[model samples]
Target chain A: MTEKTAITPATHTVPPAKFSHGVRKGDILQVAGQVGFLPAVEGQAPTVAGPTLREQTLQTLANVASVLQEGGASWDDVMMIRVYLTDTDHFAEMNEIYNAYFEEQGLKEAPAARTTVYVGLPKGLLVEIDALAVLG
Target chain B: MTEKTAITPATHTVPPAKFSHGVRKGDILQVAGQVGFLPAVEGQAPTVAGPTLREQTLQTLANVASVLQEGGASWDDVMMIRVYLTDTDHFAEMNEIYNAYFEEQGLKEAPAARTTVYVGLPKGLLVEIDALAVLG
Candidate 1:
């Protein structure tokens, strides 16, 4: 009986919140909620931050992908994702970029089962994403 | 090759106002952010909803447990849990009740690799809980 190993990122800003970045229990990798967190540029306040919401979101997912790579996995290993958007109006825009990422990754089968919702986010950020990847 | 599964509670309220009560994939159960949700008492708002934060927290965990049971599992199968509190100051009070629950459940080891954080929650709710459980 192997237990899931919890993975906490060394980059202080990767999580950008109280939660840990990812936890690997057995064959499962659970990525915590991520928002527009750019580790190198996270210090800049959103007000002063130049990256658009879409840009930041991509950057954050990139960071998550970086972690997955470190753990010997890829985006195709991801089986489920939960996206929280501060504005549902941006769902199309977010999906546009989201689909592009998957397409670029060559995930032709069922994209991960997803749940998207509009919510009030802290730090007034535009979006937050969390995921579950199976490495079994 | 296996596809992950999502779990919905049969007895609990559907589509919680703030977040999903819980989600399950395969043998792993990933509960969404849950705060002071009282299915027993109807129409109770997050503010002043629970008689106490401890009570509310317990109710929220109970809800999570119910969903696990509905999926043919139990609390003993829980692998990880992340708890968010509006105020970290309540750690002591919450811990008392939290410890009591685990003890009652005969949890010999720790109560799942756990993380607790203080954060701003919706509806002024004091606490919210999310969890992951794996059936061996």
Candidate 2:
């Protein structure tokens, strides 16, 4: 049997949170929930950056992608997505940008199964997304 | 190319929420994020039913198992899990029940890789969990 490896990426300047960002099993990568937090650049708080929902979402996805790559997975390997939004009114905008990511990659096969929830968010962030990717 | 079969269960009254509760891709079953609402019970509100996080988690996992059975998967097939807790303070309680479930089943293999998160949950629910299972 071939052994599988796992990757844990501790990024940015934030001290280690209780949980690792993600863990891989076999060929699958299950990413932890990622909220909209900017990479710390200096003395300012990372969460204070990204004043808009769209911008926060973009940053969140980028963070997810970084973790995915660390685990030998890519956006193309993502098979499922779970999105949490603080407001349903932003769904249209979120979907537009969300679709663009997959569309731009020209992923013509079965689209990644997804679920979007409109609910309260910790830190009062507007959006967050977690991903599952299979490298098979 | 080999043909793959799919299973979609509509037994519960949750309306599948945003999409199908679970999807079988290749040998892996991906279950969507499940909240603490019981579909069979009348007038079940997502937020208020579970007086505690442990109660909510059990109900949520039950809901997930129902869909897994429909998809020809079992609790033993679960390979990884991402659990969302509205408050990280509940982690100890969540793990107490989580360990009980797997221990009851005599799960000895590399324990299902798990990641826990503190986030805003739907309605007033305390916890939610999404899972990935490998059947092969």
Kindly list the interface RMSD, in angstroms, of each predicted candidate in the order they appear.
Answer: 6.4, 4.8
Q: State the lDDT of candidate 1 residue by residue for B1-136, as single tens digits.
A: 6565556675566573555555656676677766666664346433334667877878877877777777667766665566777764677777778877776767534235454545577764788787787765
Report per-candidate DockQ: 0.14, 0.13
Regions more than 4 Å wrong, model 2: A1-78, A84-136, B1-7, B13-18, B40-49, B106-109
A35-84 per-residue lDDT for model 2 (tens digits): 77777666756663476877887888878887898988777667678888
User: Model 1, A7-83: lDDT tens per residue?
Assistant: 55554253322234665656767676666655544555333123466686686577668657655667888887777
Scored by lDDT, the top model is 2
Computed on alpha carbons, the lDDT of every model, listed in order, comes to 0.65, 0.71
Measured against the true structure, the TM-scores of the candidates, in listed sequence, are 0.60, 0.58
- Candidate 2 lDDT over B47-101, as tens digits, reads 3346787778888877778767887888878887878787768989899998887
What is the C-alpha RMSD, rounded to one decimal, of candidate 1? 7.3
